[model samples]
Target chain A: MTSAVELDHVTVRFGAFTAVQDATLSIEAGEFFSFLGPSGCGKTTLLRTISGFIEPSEGQVRIGGTDMRGLGPNRRPTALIFQNLALFPMMSVAENIAYGLRVRGVSRSARREVAERLLDLIALPGHADKRVDELSGGQKQRVAIARALAVEPKVLLLDEPLSALDLKLRQHMRNELRAIQRRVGITFIYITHDQGEALAMSDRIAVMNRGVIEQVADGRTLYEAPRTAFVASFVGENNAFVGTVAEADRDRALVTTAAGPLSGRNLRNLMRTSEAVLFVRPEAVVLGEGPLTGRATEVAYEGILTHATFELDGGGRMTATIPRGAPVPKPGAAVRLGYDPADALVLPREGFAHA
Target chain B: MHSSVGHWLILALPVAVVLFYAAMALLDRRRAPGARPVSFVQRNGIAVSTYLVVAVGVWTVLLIVLPQLYMIDLSFRPRLPPTQMGGPNDVYTLENYRFFLYGSTRSTAAWNTIHLKAFALTILASVAITFLNLLLCYPIAFYMAKAASTTRMRLLMLMLIAPYWVNEILRAFAIRVLLASSGVVNQALMGLGLVSEPVDFLGLDLGLYAGLSYAYLLMMVFPLYNAIESLDRNQIEAARDLGGPWWHIHLFVVVPHAKPGIASGCTLVFMLTAGALAAPQILGGPRTLWFTPIVYDRFYQAFNWPQGAAYAFLLLVACIVFVLATMRVCRLSLGEITR
Candidate 1:
């Protein structure tokens, strides 16, 4: 089957500033894809380009293998849920959902039936007559989703629809959104700056930085084996040790840091004396005796884990998470930290610098 | 004098209510902690509050309420010679109002057709002018509010308002110059071969409509801009994204949101056009007899203040009725429109 949406080297420029530069990706049908980045990082611009609100200055946007050139947002087979949801305050919930159908010349009764069904899909069965302002934040979000879904487009684009909700509701709606996407069986393209939200909901995520798509992978792969240093630090917490490679092999390399020589897996093969940075996940750093030593600066006790920050004797800081029931080091105590060679990633020093 | 007591009481009710509220505010000085925030009177101190109340009360009573009351009183009395000022001939009566229906007795119609026709036509013309202004202004308002950059909006606003800086009478004459038989508009039309002869714009009442519409164009545009500017742009985009065409988007999303503004603009334009005297006198042809000109003839030319008061009161009533009807049709309240 053809991909649900494809961007062929799409570059959107507003005068001299390039918002999305040479972004190319393929989203399969029925996939929950996400574009994750910080604010002004071009995720929204890319989404608008796909939705046809904006035409890319260069390159083609294809939906279901058809080039969508010169088509407006209304002409495209996609709908966007704005960051504010943008529910029509003057319209009833059902009317808002049925607006797309109404524009398509659907009869009122048929539109009502579709609205009722989508209301049920969003678990808002009896809220058909409620005004948009009558809904709570999360309900507005579901209504926005339902309104987008009502068009029955091949792809639904969401621009951080849950950013306004409180934390607990946001978390709950994340699962609700994922479940709705599953039941609808249509491609969902969600944009968010929240890495946790992107990781929790997306089937395949594209990590973007400075208008560039750094890496696209599944949640697990993106967290564990990021291709670039920006993605490694952006996706999750990490302790980065900047150093030069002292020795190299096929899969492992020894990097000489200020503290001592640290050995890690060399994903980007580098020869001797090449500059590299070794990345170790907080959980992967063992607190007992090892090659690296530091003074424990601060210890924070979370429910399931205690995070210990260390001022490294080598002139940097590192954090380690001790699991529940493990001994967390005291602040001001000298501590030794280590990580397994397979758990650490030594990447080239020059990787994906943010503009 | 005895019958006027009811009118006096009707006039006093608003003043009484204001005083009662002020007294209540001044008396409710004792308060529990955080029971409620201090009243305006207490917050500003009693002297300052009283000063403000007295100032507003004096202005309203002297400037607005008193003149209207005197007009109402005069409308109910008969016109008389100076020698018979307080005589039985000067007694209160409905004769001034009955003058409007004088010719009815000679004809089958219920009222004097000439006067009534002029009044009805004046109202109808005002309504038409209000509608024309709305149509012409909605697009400009929307463009200024949503489409134009700040500099462009400022430039458009300056262009719209600069012409108004000249006196209303001067502007009407300017339109007269453009719309006369041998004016530039006719000259251009004849030059372009659109017409073989000059169109009688003033005789056809087209010049009057254009002049009144121009006079109140800002009144319509500003209210509409204020309303449409506050509308979340996303709603329009959402409508467009839902496959709505331009008209559908405006009808479903923009128009409904701008109802209060539309109502306010329509009310202002309708009232102003209905009551306009200068523009009508300057631009109106000999054929057109607007209602205000009749009122002016009664007061100044005819020296009949009672009948003029009656006609002015009737016009005011019509304006009020139009305002209420507009509010009802637009499903808005007075507060909403004012806001």
Candidate 2:
């Protein structure tokens, strides 16, 4: 099957500053893909490029195997949900949904039918005559989604549509958005700075730093086997130990740190004496018995799990999550933290080391 | 003393309303959360607040209300000589108004067609000028509000406003010079061979329309800019993303958002053009006659203050009716238009 959207070496520049550089990727049909990054990471620029708002300074954008050069946004088969949702405040709910169809010269009754069906899809049945401001934030979000889907574009671009909602609502809408994308069965390109949002909703995630795409992978792989130091630090909480490679092999390597020698799987296959950072997730660090030790500086109990922060004997800090029913450590207690070699990876400290 | 009490009674309602709102504002400020314990008197100081209230009251009651009330009273009275004032014949009458219908004619149906024609033409031309100003200013306002950079917008605003610093009559004369039969416009047209003879723009009343539209161009542009500027640009993008073309986007999004501004601008331009005397006088051709000039003749040349007051009051009524009609058509409240 042809890709729903493709970007070939897309580089967007504004005078001397480059917002997105050499972003080449293909979004498969009916797939939910997310560009995850911090603010100013050029994720939004790439989304706008696909939506035909900003033509890439250098590269081609193709939708359904057709070159989109010189096509205005009104002609593109893609719809964008703005960051603020941008619902027409002057329009009623049904009118807002039917706006695109009305622009296409569809009859009033036909447009109303489409609007009612989409409203039902967005779980907003019987809200057709309500004004835009009368709806709640989440309802407005669903309405915005319904309005975008009304156009029936091949690919839907959403620019952090949930960023305006409360935390609980954002999480709830994430699942709702995923479900809607599945029902629509269209390609979804989501942009957000929230890693959890991207991980929770996206089928495949592209992690971006500055203007470059660092890695693209499924959630599990992105968490378990991040290719870059940035992704490892950004995707989830981690305890990073920076050191030099003492010994190297195909699948595992030993790194010499200030505290002692640590061994982990070699994801980047570095040579001996080369600089590397070993990353172990907070949940993977065993706190009872291990070769490395630290003094517990802080311990926080969060119902299901207890988080313990340690001042390492080597001169850094490490955090570990102790599951419920485990003996939680108190401050000033000496604790041993260890991880299985497979759960931790030693990667070349090439990109951003901290989120 | 009895008449003085009656005068004070006339002012009572407005004064009470103003004081009520002031008291409410003070109470709100004091009762708000995190407010300091200072009283209104402590916040504004007794002398300063008193001065401000007194100044505003004096300006409103003395300058604005008194003149309008006097004019309304005079509109109903006869233009008697001072020696005969308050005599046996010094009573309220509608003779000044009836004079408007019959000018100097004895028959009612054989009315003052010339003055009536001038009145009708002035109103129609003012409406046309208002519409022309709206059409001409919308794109410029949209460009300034949405498309231009900050520096460019500032520059455009300066260019639009720089000419207004000159006197209004001087600007009218400038328009007259540019639109005269043998003026620069005709000279250019003849030089370019666009016409065989001078077009006689002033003779055709094109100069008057152009002058009036120019006189109120900023009035239209600023309100439009204010309304359009506050619109979230993402809404425009959202419309386009939904496959709305340019005109459709404007129709569905931009224009709806700009309704209040359009209504206010049109009202201002229409009222100002209808009451304009200087521009008409400066740019009017040999045969051009506007209602305001006739009213001016009643006041100064004819020295018929009652008839002048009557004509001016009628024009004011017409303007208020236009404003009400605009409000009804645009479905906007008075507060929204003024806002």
Per-prediction TM-score, chain B alone: 0.90, 0.88
Which portions of model 1 show Cα errors greater than 4 Å?
Answer: A271-274, A351-355, B1-14, B17-37, B103-110
Scored by lDDT, model 2 comes in at 0.90
lDDT of 1 by residue, B1-339 (tens): 543564676578667987898788656654444467767788999999999978997898878887888788888877878887656566677777778876422344466777888899999999999999999999999999999999999999999999889999899999999999999999999999999989999999899999999999999999999999999999899999989999999988999999889988999999999999999999999988899999999999989998899999999998899779868876889899998
Cα lDDT for residue B316, candidate 1: 95
Q: Write the per-residue lDDT of candidate 2 for residues B11-69, one digit (tens) a residue.
A: 66556777899999888887887966776568899998889878988899778876776
- The lDDT for every candidate, in the order shown, is 0.90, 0.90
What residue runs in model 2 are displaced by over 4 Å at the alpha carbon?
A353-355, B1-49, B105-109
Docking class of 1: high
